[model samples]
Target chain A: MELTGAEIVCESLLKEGADVVFGLPGGAVLPLYGALSVYPAIRHILVRHEQAAAMAADGYSRATGKVGVCIATSGPGATNMVTGIAAAQMDSVAVVAITGQVPRPAIGSDAFQETDVTGVTLPITKHNMLVMDVKDVAQAIHDAFHIARTGRPGPVLVDIPRDVLLGDKTEFVWPSEPKLPGYKIPTVAPEAQVAAAADLINQAERPIIMSGHGVLISHAYGLMTDLAEKAQIPVITTLLGISAIPSSHELNLGMSGMHGMAYANLAIDEADLIIGLGMRFDDRVTGRISAFAPNAKFIHVDIDASEVDKNIKATVGMVGDLKAVLGQLLPKVEANVHIDWLQHINELKAQHPSHLVRESDELLPQYVLQRLTEVTQGRGIVVTGVGMHQMWAAQHCRFTEPNTFITSGGLGTMGFEVPAALGAQVGRPDVTVWSIAGDGGFQMTMCDIATAVEAHADVKFAILNNNSLGLVHQLQELFFDKEYIASQYTANPDFVKIAEAYGIRGIRVTRKDQVLDAVQQAMETAGPVIVDFMVKEDEGLYPFIPSGQSVKEMLEEPTLKEIT
Target chain B: MVQSNHTEQHTLIALVEDKPGVLTRVASMFRRRGFNIASLAVGNSEQPGLSRMTFVVNGDDHTVSQVAKQLDKLIDVIEVSDITNKSTVTRELALIKVKTNQMTRGEIIQIVNLFRANIIDVGSESMVIEITGEEDKINALHNLLSSFGVIEMLRTGLVAMVRGQTNGLANGHSEQVNSSSNS
Candidate 1:
């Protein structure tokens, strides 16, 4: 039973059923790497950069609903994971990050490869610990995983010193459970509160249920659908909440917010009763707080009480697990219908249809996404980096299952698609995973193409090669009078050639006829493949709501009649 | 989100595990949320291996409640109570140094007697008076001593307890608010 700190780390991870970890080795973590070699069944994907390691773990967690694990050395290796950790925290993904630290004796001396990573990551993580004693390694890892996977799941860090890994010896005994008295999450809402919410839902004529990531997190999609169908109410999903209910379902209105569907925003504004389930009223979703859903009486239900009334005031706030609350509410909610309200929503959708991206000779991003929809048959998991391509994917791709549409909505982190797709593919090897990224974001983490090739992760990359930062350029065109300063990249590398250099198949398509064939080729290829679609540079996301503006002030592309 | 009339002061008491880096976690939570802490006092509590912290916050109700819930989310924090609206006996101790002259010496003593303060230390031209009372009383004493040309002052923030055995530390403001609204 006697084991070194390094052995305890691996043993505890194995005990928690973590079979895969994404990491890179360094001088400070050599002991851990040695211990890792003993466990041949545990897979470790060697990432090109520490940031990709953290992001890959995040993607794995989101895909599998298990705590994703990543490892790094101290100093630069640990600091480089900050962006990815912050992304996981923002998205509320369960990730446990383990970093090597300097020996306890030399910790404050600013020794080589020494950094206060616990202090540095405190604000970004849900919880973090610096383990100084050797006996605490197993318990620390146990506690870290428990905290990461529990209430309002987020990233947690455990920094272990080198001396503890190398010098100290202790019996590795896994505690029965975490001895955390302060860690508790309420599971049930009060009966009266649930009754009040049900009463409001039963009485209202026009009601809409706004779903966020919590729906997916709690695995309450079935209950959510039951409630929506039982009540005959419409559901508008947030950007991250894309697949909470099937898009094909008659009740599901598309994405809501800045780049969301115009009809969805209109429905929310027109609703008389708004039941906010597991979704925060982010500023992006609610354009102007005072004017957002001006007519709605809100009922907010979330596990996190702090989120209740943090953005918009709720008439009745029910704080508990979404699944449990919905369970208690499903019976109390009477089966009803709003035929007039549904007809009105249909009218709104008919009136403000999104402007289609026209195809001339060059490839349009939307056209490619539409083609992807056709090719995947709404069966593939689509991951996206932030920008025009993300919005385009949200608009075009058909997500039918929960956790199928993965993207960084809260942090809006760029360069997320490549690593996230790889992690998702690794987590769910049976499914087809695609990374839809813009040219700028593709270049940011394109170095990870080598990582994909090494792991033989079957992930397809569709780079919307617009040769410009399309979203930022569009912002400049709208606000700065088209003075593109730092937004545009003058010289760009050939992405197809870059992927081919990493022993991955690559293809480039320019004309309209070459789009579907190229996409089909990437899908049928054996290993990782990249299809660089030479898209138009000036295609702006239309029906835009400018920052700090109300939903009523959205600008839409004029049709020929309006133009005349 | 109810907007307050103005920036109102709130007193929050929290019981946390006596663990290393616990204070930093609490302080960092407040800083990240952009809620300013006017005063903070930390010491061992009645329970073993636990510390009690009382901090004064000035912000709208939305931000203050946010801080309280976020503090509750920390692993080291066992419970948090916003006793600003509750019936409690709150006390703060302060030491004020007043520059005493021939004409103001008697006047300062009379004022100190009125305030029921003690002369803790006496220098050649200055006397340090120590006082312990509610926040308003301390503020009043400080205001009166300032007329005698005060040199320095230090205050321990407000620490409070419920007047009776109502167990204010057992549950947070949310539970109390829920019960009060029902009645």
Candidate 2:
């Protein structure tokens, strides 16, 4: 039973049922790499960058609902994992990041390749540990997996010192249980609050359901859709909650908030009863807190109790797991609700649907997103980088199931899609993975294209190239009186050339007519492929109701008249 | 203003690396959890480099348990125990600054004398009284002195140790010794 500390780490991972680990080898982590060679059951993916390792693990965790594991060496190797860890934390992905550290004696002395990896990532992770002892290695790994997957799932870092990894240990014994005093998972729903919510829903004349990423995370999409259908309520999803319900459904009102459909925003404004599910009312969604649904009676249901009253007061607050709360409320709720409200919502939906100018020659971001959705038939996982392309994917992509469309919701981290797609592809090899990134965001971690090629993952990168930080540029044009600032990046590299350099297939589309062909070609490529769609810069995401403003005050449609 | 409402309470114990900034992270966590610590104590354990943090908090049992679980999840925290059931001892230290003029100086001194509190420092208009006991005992003394204008207060959060000699280091210490000898 005797094993080296490094061997204990690999053994503990196997015990936790990890079949694969995504990472790269370095000096500090040589011990782990040496130990990993003996275990043939667990596959170690060599990523091009440490950041991609973290993203791939995030994707794997989201797809499998298990703790995604990634490893890296000390210093820059550990620092590179920060973005991915922060993304996972923001999106509540279950990921365990293992990094190598300098020896214990040299920790504060700033030894070779020594960095305070734990302190650097403290704010970004749910929890982290620096293992200095050989005996604590197994327990630390076990505890890392346990903490990452339990309660509100998030990333946990386990930094093993180089000396400890090389140190000898008598036996590796994983902790039988994690004894955490302050980390209780709330399992019971308050009966009074549930009854009150049900009563309000039944009595309300104008009820609207607002869904968020929590609904998808809890896998309560079915219950949510059923509730909307049974109660005849119009459902409005946040950008992150796009795939929680099918867009084809009669009750689906597209997205809500700044760039939401005219009807969804207006409906929220007029609603007397608002059932907010698993969504923290971000500034994008609530224009102004004071004017946000002022007349509505709010019933907020979330697993995190802190989110309930943090922003936007709630008339009834139910704190527990989303699916469990909905499971209880569904039975007590009545079926076949009043038809008048549904008809009113349908009328609004028909009156003002999401429409864009369809010119035959002009390349548009909307056309690219729609074509990708068509080519994939909404069957594969779609990850997105933050910016104009993220909003486009959220608005245009037709998602049929939950957890299929993954993006950085809370943090809105740019350059998230490419590596995240690699992770998702590794997790679900049978399914196709599409990473939608803008020109600026795609450059952030496009080196991960090499990782995709190495892994031979079936991933397609749809780079919406506008040659600018599209979101920021749009904001500048609208709010800052056309002061472009640092939003524009001149002398942009040809993404196709860069993709070819990574040993991956590449294509470029300059016209709207070529979008479908480019997407189809990328989809059929055996390995990773990048399709750079040359979109026009300076196109604003429309129907934006400025933050802190009422939904009624939204720019309903793009106007020919210029703002004074 | 003290509310006349009954609140639930629980005991929490956390094993953390004896280092700087560890206490700050633990304190921030307590503040974030919205649980008021009744008593807190921190001291070096038999394990040369680790410290044991013990605190009693008031909240629903589930919330208290959650707080313990969360504290255990901290990177500096090696282990966590809710020694509410297990045999353990909990204590806290408090220093209260009291405002006393000619009218209430004697009364203030009388209350401090009764509680066996020591006067650590004295100002022109106020005297700082130091006391160490269970949180309830300090609360009782605080309640008694509130009638005579209280100026400031400093309370160390509760830290607890398990009964007898079953320390964290002791359990693993012998095993380490045996392995080293065998090698």
Candidate 3:
């Protein structure tokens, strides 16, 4: 079948099963957008900012495990997507960002809207290509999707020159198979590593399983839970590893790190055999590398080999798909009782419990999260921006399924929740979608409200307007001698008015009594709705152990008795 | 997770038809599959057309062999070989600028002379030292120079080639055929 290069691009996308693309049109991308008109099956979302388009795609990919697609024009459009692409790379989200570039001849001459987007995005993307030849367009798109969707998935940019889009391409041959030499997906877990891991699990007196985002990405949650339960091992999660095991599970010890649960951190410190699953020991988790579980014999399992010894030393390092490694080790692992370890963990949990007391007039963020969790029954998708709100959501919101809760864990990118929620809603329209963002982070991508309004995406955004960078302010108050620096942002916009500007339903909740009613009203609305909850500015997240410190060293709750 | 201490080193150089993501795919392969790469370097080759990549990695002999075999399977890669012990010429270049005042200048000069490194650029307060050798040699120099205050350091990671009268491209074809037949 003979098709133009632009048609071939769209056709290849359809072939790869892309249901939607987030983008905006410009002179360079007119032909591709024109070609997209013919394909009614694929929905195209026009985001206000090119950055949001890339972020929306990232969110879509993270939620659905599909290649999230985004399109933008040349120059500024391409540059705008860099931050989003970098965020995806950092967190390992599968995304294919397609940008239209000037013709081949004008690439270096700085012609109208001309930019070497491939060069600009080189370091940020997993891989990138600039297509000058019409024949290579189809193959490039095919290869882009393949590269984006496979092993340690990340963003791949394909910059299509404007002239190439206008050219006539008759030979439309998608590569029968992607011939990437260095892209091998290791299918088997090394038997020796698996056996060694099983032996360590069997012999360990104080065993702790530290789960990370890789477990969810590899779909090893069930296997992990089974192993933890059967072996009677306590499980602690990284911020990204939340929902890997149900928060309600007895073995689940919530989160560990700077703002992690006291018990979780304590367990990690005291553990003799630390089995790290699908997680890189970032500074947040390890606090002080030298002092972090100094006595523990570490068993690190992750798909990324580079991460094995890059951080903490591992006694048993297995590099393969977490799902496969856990599968192989599951049967060989003997069922044993770590009753003493469990008792110690329980004691720690009792010592420091997350307690939030809502006043009669003050709208607490925890209450909103708890109510949302109740209404959703942990069945729908919940996304959050980076801040105190995110920690609250992670602590309070119970996610029962994989891919149900998406947040920027590695990069901790703020302004991620709204667009991510939009993408999640688009990907899974049948399920309820909730975006929880702090006042500070919410304003970063607040424009995405228009994206929701335009697509009529059924998403509910809960803006916890504490009127400050709550996380930073909390740290300053606790550790920085109460000197707020770059944490306070006064004179904020009326969120209700902003939502109204986007043609979406908006409500403001100042009192605790109005919190549930506002949320319920937003949920009942058919399309996108935003409920701005005026939370307490002085409110702080609790159970925060200073970084590099032991879990036992955490401040159980706010020191101010009045706030409590 | 079981940690295997048997860190087998293999040096692989691939001659690829210059294209994008050929490196990413290769790096992604090692990264995603958890192949321990000791050192990796990629740049334009002598051949007017192709790019050469050198990868120093630690894996089982079978796995390293499989990686070479797999490289041959890639359409863009012209050749790949484990050049760890194949009589290869290996070298690495590093430019390290040290922060030194009058007090530390004599000590820095002494360290540089002991390492047989050349001083590329000399400032009133600093000196840029150029050193080329194996990775360990560079590390040793870096360690000794750290006390004198290293202001900046840039290493052009290891680039290698077979020393004998043989080209990787020629051997690549036979291995490709052998692997295809084996498959």
Candidate 4:
């Protein structure tokens, strides 16, 4: 019954069903690392950087639907996890981050490796606790997991002082239930609001369901698809909502946003009823709030009431679990196909087919992604870093399952794919996990190649190596009159050589013909492999809406020619 | 001044378990959401191990409700109600220090007596007067005392209650009140 705080932490984690923890050891966390040896069931992954630790835990959480645990020493270690924590918060991934603080007496003295991690992570975390006493350790851990995985899940931090971990001794008893009083999680929405939403769906001649990450969180993909098909509504997914329903589904209208498919954005504009489920109408999705879906009446469904009508006004707001709302709604909604609307959507898709330029010997990012998709048969989980490549993957890859197409959609954090893919691979060893990154972003956390080698993660990296920040370069070329500054990297590192140095197999392909073979080879490899596909530098996201412009002002390649 | 359509004062009453750092959680929520508190007061509630916090928040009607909703989501919070539009009794306590001379001391006492305020502390050259009233009344007294060259002033913000026998904490206004209370 008696245990140190460190032992209490391990026992609590075991009680919470955490089989693995991703973290790095530092000065303040020595006691934790010492105690970790005694508990063999909870495996600890030693990441190269604190950021990777957080990112890996985020990936694990997204892949497994459990609260991923990551730990770090205080000060710089805790600060390094800031980006990953924010990314998890933005994407609503459930992660419990633990940081070691200085001893209780030395907290205010600014002792070695001291930081106010609880204070620092307040805005980014759903909730956080600083355990000043050993008695509070188990309860705090229990509450951290409970808070992180509940309704509208997010990251939570528990800061344990070094002395608490090493000094204080107490009788440890795991509470049968977490003593969280104020945490009321909504399982079902109000019936009247659900009926009102159902009414709106039934009444609309052209309705569009804009699905977001909530579908995956609630595991309501079946219900969402049923609602979409039964109502004969087109489904436009947010960037994070990519795999809510399979991309190949008849009603699934691809991604909708700044870099979204032309037809999907057009459908959103033309729809009379917009049912926004579990996704915040972010600025990127709605170019100009005043002009966004001007003709549509919104029916917002989310677990968090605050998100409803925070951006665009919701005519009918259903605040609760997405699955419960859809369950209540499916019975009332009548099956009817909007034939005219479907015909119009087809016409728009025909007009703006995703540009697939396959000139001799030239490798386009889209071609690489499509080839990668073909090599994997779209069966693998693709974790993407941000940039033109991310959009390319979103547009080109076929995602058949929910939570398989994971990315940092809300925070748009680059360097995410590498560590995240490692975590994903660790969590789901049976599945093929691919980390797709641009050359610029791949370099940011390529240090985690060592982590992949150490963990023996069977993750494949599809580096769309354009040797520059392609998205920013395209922006500058389009808007800055070709005055490229920091966007272009004068000397990019040879990624294959770096990967090889890190003891992972590496291959480079400059020509389009080599993409398929390289991707296939990387997929066939026993361990982590990086395929550097040298893509064209000038390639830009087509049907792009300029900043501050309405969806109506979208510019394709021809429109760019006209403007120039 | 042309007022923004979104700007309005919202009075919120929250019942939270009296535990360490509950105040910090509530305060941090407001700070993180960037909602400036006009005034705030916290004290032990009628229920044991429970604290009631009254906050005057300045935000649009939508955002104020959002703050309340977010507060309810915190682990320690038990219940939150926007008592802004409710018929309620609100009171604020303040201690005002005014620089009073021989010429103005008698006049200050007369004005204090008129407002039913007490002179809590009298200094050699100044007087610290105490008053408890609605915010408007306290402001009025402060305005009158300012003419006598006010030195320092401290206000306890505002605390409120509904007019009738409706117990804000006991009713099904929140989850698990009776369950936790029984234990």
DockQ metric, candidate 2: 0.10
lDDT per residue as tens, model 4, A1-564:
799999999999999999999999898887999999999999999999999999999999999899999999999999999999999999999999999998888888888778888878877888888898999999999888988998899999999988899985899999767777667777788888888888888889989999999988999889999998887888999998988898788888898889888778888888899999999899889888888899999999999877877788789988889998899989989889888898888787777764343343568788888888887877879999998889888888988878899898889999999999999999999998999999888889999989888888899988888778999998999899999989888798888888889888899999878888898888788999988888887877776888777878987655322111
Model 3 lDDT per residue over A1-564, tens place: 888888888889989999899998898988999999999888999998888898889888877888899999999998888888888888888899999988777778979988778777766777788887898888888878887776667899999988798776677887776655434455556899889989999999999999998888888999999999999998888888888888678898888887777667777788899999989898888877777886699999977665776577678888788888898999999998888889877776666555333443566778878877877778888999898899888778887877888888777889989888898888888888999999898889988888888888898898888889999898898789999899888889998888888888889988867766777787788898888888877877876768667555667665323221
Model 4 spans > 4 angstroms off: A355-361, A559-564, B1-6, B169-175, B178-183
True contacts kept of 3: 0.05
Interface RMSD of 4: 5.8
Best by DockQ: 4
Candidate 2 Cα misplacement greater than 4 A, ranges: A355-361, A559-564, B1-22, B28-183
Off by over 4 Å in 3: A355-361, A547-553, A559-564, B1-17, B20-51, B54-183
List RMSD in Å for every model shown: 3.5, 7.8, 8.6, 2.8
Ten-residue stretch with the least lDDT total in model 3 chain A: A555-564
TM-score of each: 0.96, 0.81, 0.81, 0.96
lDDT of 1 by residue, A179-199 (tens): 666777778999999999999
Single out the weakest 10-residue window by summed lDDT for candidate 2 chain A.
A555-564
Cα RMSD over interface residues, candidate 3: 8.2
The 10-residue segment with the lowest total lDDT in model 1 chain A: A555-564
Taking the tens digit of each residue's C-alpha lDDT, what string does model 1 give over B1-183? 445566799989988878999999999988877779999999997767778899899987878888898898898888888888999888999999999978788888888899999998877799999999999999999988887888999998888877886656866433433232210
Q: Which segments of candidate 1 are over 4 A away from where they belong?
A: A355-361, A559-564, B101-103, B172-183
